[model samples]
Target: MSLALNIHSQRFQLIATAVAASLVTAGALAAYNSVSKRERRRNLSEEVLRSVSNEASVHTLPDYSVYKEDASNVRYDEELIREQLARNYAFFGEEGMAKIRGGSVVVVGCGGVGSWAAVMLVRSGISKIRLVDFDQVTLSSLNRHASATLNDVGTPKVKCLERNLKQIAKWIDVDCRAEIWRKEEGGDLLEGVDWVIDAIDNISTKVDLLKYCHDHNLKVFSSMGASAKSDPTRIQISDISHTIYDPLARSVRRRLRLLGVTSGIPVVYSTEVPGDVKLLPLPEEEFQKGPVKELGFFDDFRVRILPVIGPLPSIFGLNIATYILCELAGKPILNPLPIKNRKKLYERLLRDLLHRESKLTGETINKLPIDEDDVGMIFEDVYLGRSVIPPHLVPSRPALTRWILTQPLTPENCVVMEYADAEKHVKECSNPTIHPRDIWGEDVNALVERRSEEVARQRAPA
Candidate 1:
């Protein structure tokens, strides 16, 4: 019995020794891996520093001391940047990637839309960028901002973007400007850039920036309203003149036209009509305290905030980045499918309108004052593919009808209505005793009058 016990005790001792040896081996391996990782990181840092030093003699590099622990030894890791951008290289090819890498972009307004755009542009092989913003990162910005954290609140938005962007691509050159973009100083801010992205939310500032880019003949892409928009599918890229349903676009288009810019600029806009979403109201006490203009950061800047669904602005930014990248790579989006390739629809509408006008006037009319393009603008832009009547319902059989029979069928006088509504309007207008305002209410008349003014403004000489 004593001999059996001794053998069992020896077996237990053997098992314990094996377990201890296994634990020791695991700990040693873990220590080795940790040391190796640190060594690898240190080596990479040194390599990047050396590469940057070599490139520094060719051209001046931006101050990157803040990003590195060893501020004296700043670096550019070409191999790392290349590895990071391998996918883009694959897609754009060597020649295209060369252009993309060489291109520089300036983004105004480092908010939700601008932040995401700047981030992606840097990630997509754009090595140089200028971030300009007068505002600071707010706690509220975390919802849609690409990189802002709780710690970034109250800091200049441009600085925030610059820091985060440098982390993305150590080789990237980011010019951070924490100042408002005004016409007087825009030249200094915008000079020496390949492309300018207008993401300013304030209307006046946006218009000024666009006009500056237009006058200077800079290749500029603008982002229209993303606030109060939720449907990502409805977002589209089109010429500024073709944007519709977005009040911000309409205002910008009108202002641009008055400034002698009918349409050469490209804009990203949403067709989703803001149903009932309104700007957040200010507190009653605040309104009573003083003039509302005093409440704004700057005069004429918006005091009330627009409600934003987080994802919409990011989508807008993505679209902007994608477009600019393609253009820089010499592969422009010849035709964005979202901007409906429906020339046939426009032509059919024009034909139907001409026939209807002839029938109503009892004369064989060859043409009207408007063409298919004008009809399209009236149908899609002005009327938003809905009847101009009460409730503005989308009709099953929509037709373009002359609003006032006494007046000629000009773009301003045209309106979209159901076939039945058009027939009713024609019948009512046939009687000289009845005025069109009497048939459609004063509210409708007011709306039509506003639309007419808008159309007239658009048609005015640039």
Candidate 2:
């Protein structure tokens, strides 16, 4: 019994020793791995943080010392500036903001897109912006235009925009020119600008500016007609050279081609003419009648007379601002992604699948032949969205429908249906029919009275 007990005791002791040894080995290995992993993690984190911080700070605070010493360089209202910065960071990653600050931008028009571009550029901490416009504030410009007000009537656009920009950033260096952008002066004006944004409405001026930019190797973006449309989805930023079969873009391309220009110019444009084209000039006689007194001179002049409500210039202005932000920040969030990926098999497969589905669903649309008898009437009514021939007029037979589709009708409504095309149509029709100019006209007498009061107040005070 003693011998058996001694053997059992010896076995238990050996077991205990083995467990301690195993535990000691495990602990040593764990300690070595923990130390190595911690060192590696620290090195990696420091490298990444250094790269991002160094790039981002160039556009951000730069240095804490610089921020503290100069009250005028940064907005005194730090909270507001910080809020705006945070929003900007959300839209453009930190690296992008750095690029924006490092670059210089010039805006060629102060109306609609130009105004918003100016505001956005300043808000993004783009230290320098040059604004060029030769127009004056008018009663009709109160809505979509930024610096337009009852008091700003007849005031130069540059001065008005300057005042508003001052409120946004005290340190911003805004170069305002109260002169039209002349092609002759293009080289000098665009010398140091990293990018030029074309918001000018005049076709000749647009062509000249584009050619100048192309020749100078300066990056430029031009806005297509934004006055008559509202669908924001159809609007995109792309190289103008590749845009094909679009009417507005076609016109621009033709104009550029006439100047012996080739493709590859960047542009921001919509694919369709807006449905709310009623504001456009009805006829030469009607247009010659001058501004409607009720509508005011500026309002009558700017609104193209048409039937459907269309895109207000304000919406386009906002879109223009967004594109500028994307370009400056080196981001590419603009839709239609510009046709740079046509080679991908997945994309082709998806397109083929869509085509097959359309065929199966009877969604393979066929163009109806236009009948000469109904061309004018149908064409006019098409803009109004009420079919000239009522749906009830068609016979309730598949054969009749097929015959209608096959028949040569002069007033044929050829419908091409696609998500992108429909979106473009809607964007072109985004006009907020509300007129802010009417309010300005109503305040004219009050404005005169206020001026008189101001004169009296100044005399009394002095």
Q: What Cα-based lDDT does every candidate model obtain? A: 0.83, 0.57
TM-score leader = 1
Best by lDDT: 1
Runs of candidate 2 exceeding 4 Å displacement: 1-84, 90-93, 242-247, 279-311, 334-462
Candidate 1 lDDT, 253-337, residue by residue in tens: 8778879998899889998865554455566776574454421112222433667888999999999999999999988999876
The CA lDDT at 280 in model 1 is 53
10 residues in a row with least lDDT, candidate 2: 395-404
The count of backbone overlaps in candidate 1 is 0
- Runs off by more than 4 Å, candidate 1: 1-72, 283-304, 341-384, 388-397, 402-415, 435-462
- Residues 231-342 of candidate 2 have per-residue lDDT tens digits of 6666666677655323345446656876888676766765443442334444657556454321111233423332212234555566666666777788855553654432
